[model samples]
Target: MNYIKKTDAYDIYIEPSRKTIVIRQKWKYIWSVASGLPNWSYLEKKAWHQKADNVIWLQWGSHFVFWALVHDENNSNVSLHKKEFNLEFDIQWVTTDQHWTANVKKIGASEDFGSKVNPSDKKIYLAHTDVKRRIVSNINQNTVKHEFGHTIAVNDEYGKLNGNYYDPIYVNDTKALMNVGNELRARYIRDIKIKVNKMIPGVTFATFLDK
Candidate 1:
């Protein structure tokens, strides 16, 4: 594996034996808002900052917020089927009740399902039931993780329009992160690959699914 790029939010590496490109994205939530008021550390809460529900600057970084990382190893490597090479997400989630980096909000149990507002939307709306057990357990449920997939730009794969978006050859795949499953498919990492290529000049990796 050859290291390609490194940033506060992610790191890139190329693994030749498996013909896979790796992206290790840091799961820290950086929340900062310029305020006329002084930075406030809410003693009542574990999260301390300038004090507000909203933030003007929110991004992924490793230094600021210290939260335990939860790994989704189920979805972090290229599949071994048909010699197909594709990108995959090796996400490291920092554990905490509050994720200032993600625009995740809790909705009522009456809601039909958890959803990411849009393809490029950073916000995620998850039903309260999906998050209740995860609060203290530190183990994220499938619903919560599925919505998290959207924040990184992976589209849904259940419908006719979406299945072809990533895993074009997949059928009723229910065990992957975006397809209401926990196991990730190869093409799910397309967006991340595109982003990486754009960031590093003279470097391009083909996503086998696109071929």
Candidate 2:
């Protein structure tokens, strides 16, 4: 019956012997309006649902079990299981018709369009332009998974710090999800498990997988 205080960050609370750990995620989708575009209601709904689908793809291929429930302002009554780990995301969509600079504040305004997790607020932000680009390039799911990985404290596999790669282990792993535009890889799963184990006390990926 151990309980961990939930902060503005992802937190896990579980019994030492519990084999299955469910990660519950809540998502909020926002879209900016553009002139001459399709109806805002329809476009927003489609984008929001597509984001949910992309996140589900991540959960299905990852090592841990996640019960991700995404909701917009309209549909918020979906049943979500009570779980040990939880994450929240604010996904924003900026239409192509609007200038990027004009909407930077709403798009999370970073030099890198890479998504980030705000541990202080327990929220992840994904830029609209980044999403649209990935969608056009047919790599939306991969980008989605990469951003989600950051929520669990996983470092960018392709990122550099002080001229050194964050995780040299993944330097050559072109298919590592944490790497730029890469697919899911077993090593990425293992990396996530290691990070999660360190974050949550008495909960290990081994136990979850064994279940």
Candidate 3:
């Protein structure tokens, strides 16, 4: 009736006859930040991609993931490993680009564009121009989880399509994780659903609405 395939990056679910595919990721993350002296900004703008931090992997990863795994849904809307698309996740720590590697910098997006993935390389370019730090920010983690949605083919439900990124038309739509909010929806799984449907003819992803 259903088949599940696990990998280092994601778990693939396939119901061939029914043509339904659900992909849940188990992301291990390592972050690179600009920690230089007064020149942190200059270095950050230069856009240097630093190597992952080992200590961050140890502390942040364990705390965020392990705690989420043990806890129940206080509010699944903002939680990681839970989604409206029949998706869930498990995150650990790793120092590889193949994993959820982020360039946490005080440049780009954070001030405006928000976070985005480099489509060519499939790497996360997280904008940290806001908070001090949040490594171990993947899987069930809200911030990282939102960005991860992009990597696995989730689209921005915010302003991009309606107009420019500056448009506030969808600002109020931020309750969904893909938006600037904390929820997940069928549209978040749109791209992946298409890909899956292509692979297995007639596979349909059921749609759902928020409660």
Candidate 4:
């Protein structure tokens, strides 16, 4: 539960008019040392997002999760996926040895719903593999962006479903990316811009939001 330091630079940039934003990210797939590395391409493909303008690009050496997993010589109390930008996995074969299961889990207190976002910390935790799989299958999909929505302080519209208090505006709007669908609505974009503006001052999102 790392809080976002006021001094920390914003990790996201938004352009409300064009409805696009860029999120900086890093990733790591932790497997048993016995398990050889999985194909990076397959992982990348699964994690690819199909959104037309939104992007979540990987930034090397910046994935705190990967670093903690690899460097936990003492196996210290490392909270996976529950902390900032951390995604942890335990490798397992699916149908065959060649096939790998992307089993993801959260390492902290249980919530009425699933997944969480700490805007101050700029982190999104996908609590279940089903959610993670969906996200990896299409990284730029609404689910991924929905979590990104949390990183920017966007409140959840759906209540129990996503572990937050209910909000009618998001729940009734299926097209709203922050709710429970794949479409990215204009309102969500505008909401995000407003939130980002308040969270991070003195930054201009390239005219990407204008279009």
Candidate 5:
């Protein structure tokens, strides 16, 4: 009973009129995924969103649901950091193992939506399953960004874009975010920088905060 109708590019918009489930902005939401470490603050203040309009946090169902109910006010209780950013993620969950088979599936979420402007209220739903598995840092970050790319309505199908640019190969193992010491991490940073160049022009994270 899972009906997936592809929208434009990486954007998968589910019409609320068609399905019983509806996710809207301006509401505190949650997913059912597990967060290995607390304070998903890494995403909140990061310079990663200079170009994107919306971002979604997809994970296991339990994790999503728990976070949604517990720590959404000012996104403060959720983080240990003293200074909090004006951040909120429209959380969603995958709920089953099968749902993870999409073109850019992760544990319970896909980075498959976009924001037209900074703090864009446009929504993106991350999908993930209830299944549990070990997710190391590099693997986790790759999955996170890949799906985040989807959230920005970027193409999941690599062939459509410049092969030299959005290479999925860079997301594998050493080239992943979890593999911090690897050259791929350097490459990933460069890729994000290129995206920022398009989004914010000459702005750099160094101008705002340290990494």
Candidate 6:
């Protein structure tokens, strides 16, 4: 079997100022105002999960809406790492939790399922309608990145460390950031391809939904 060699990867840079906005907007979109403030660390660990949600949302609304991200300041501390990875964006730097109910109310989702008033039992909960439609109606690209990344984890047999490897290594193959390594790489083009293949069967490497 031939391994999918990384291709068409490009460096991504977010001015420190814009990075914060992107993260916040994405969180706002994903968690929704109804979901209230999100845990930053939780977002860091599993941000890619937001992608499927965003795609679903786009399918439903087909409009770009503003999203605001709030962090729980009581326990918020994210690092600013060099975006040396192949990915063009980083959602790890956003961490602030000001209880803002207005945003959630604006979307008519105030009494919705994930409101702070009634947080979901699941760590990450998607609206059933959105799931049924195979779309995420209110989240953004970054949120999708955060949430989908969570699904790629597997425990190590030796119990050494929490190896959050997205791309698992094969026999005698070196670990790649797109595969199983700590650092995010500049290879999200490959990452997205992998996710799309899983989410929509029969998708080829070159196929992508129109933006």
> After superposition, which runs of candidate 6 have C-alpha atoms over 4 Å from their true positions?
1-87, 90-159, 162-191, 195-203, 206-211
Residue 151 lDDT in model 4? 41
Cα RMSD (Å) per model? Answer: 13.2, 11.8, 12.3, 16.6, 17.6, 19.9
Per lDDT, the best of the predicted structures is 2
Model 2's alpha-carbon lDDT is 0.44
lDDT of 5 by residue, 33-130 (tens): 24442333434323222212132333211111110122234543333222211111332233332112222112325433321121143334433321
For candidate 2, lDDT tens digit of each residue in 68-185?
2323324332222223332223222334321111121123333345456554444555555434335423233445556666655567776564476677767666446676655544
- Cα lDDT tens digits for candidate 4, 36-106: 43433545434432220123222111121211122243433333212223221111223332221222342
lDDT value, residue 76 of candidate 2: 35
TM-score of decoy 3: 0.46
User: How displaced is residue 135 in candidate 3, in Å?
Assistant: 17
Q: Indicate the TM-score of model 1.
A: 0.41
Assess candidate 3 and give its lDDT. Answer: 0.44
lDDT of each: 0.42, 0.44, 0.44, 0.35, 0.27, 0.27
Best candidate according to TM-score: 2
Q: Please, what is the TM-score per model?
A: 0.41, 0.48, 0.46, 0.38, 0.23, 0.19
Q: Candidate 3, residues 1-211: lDDT per residue as tens digits?
A: 4656554345566543433344544333334444452334545533322212222222122221111121334533233222223333333334543544555554433334355666455466655432223333231224555556666666565665435673354556756666655555555545544444343222333444333
Query: Clashes in model 3: which pairs?
Result: 19-203, 80-140, 174-181, 177-183
Deviating ranges (above 4 Å) for candidate 1: 1-114, 128-141, 160-171, 206-211
Per-residue lDDT of model 1, residues 4-47, tens digit only: 76654446665546555555554433322233423324341223
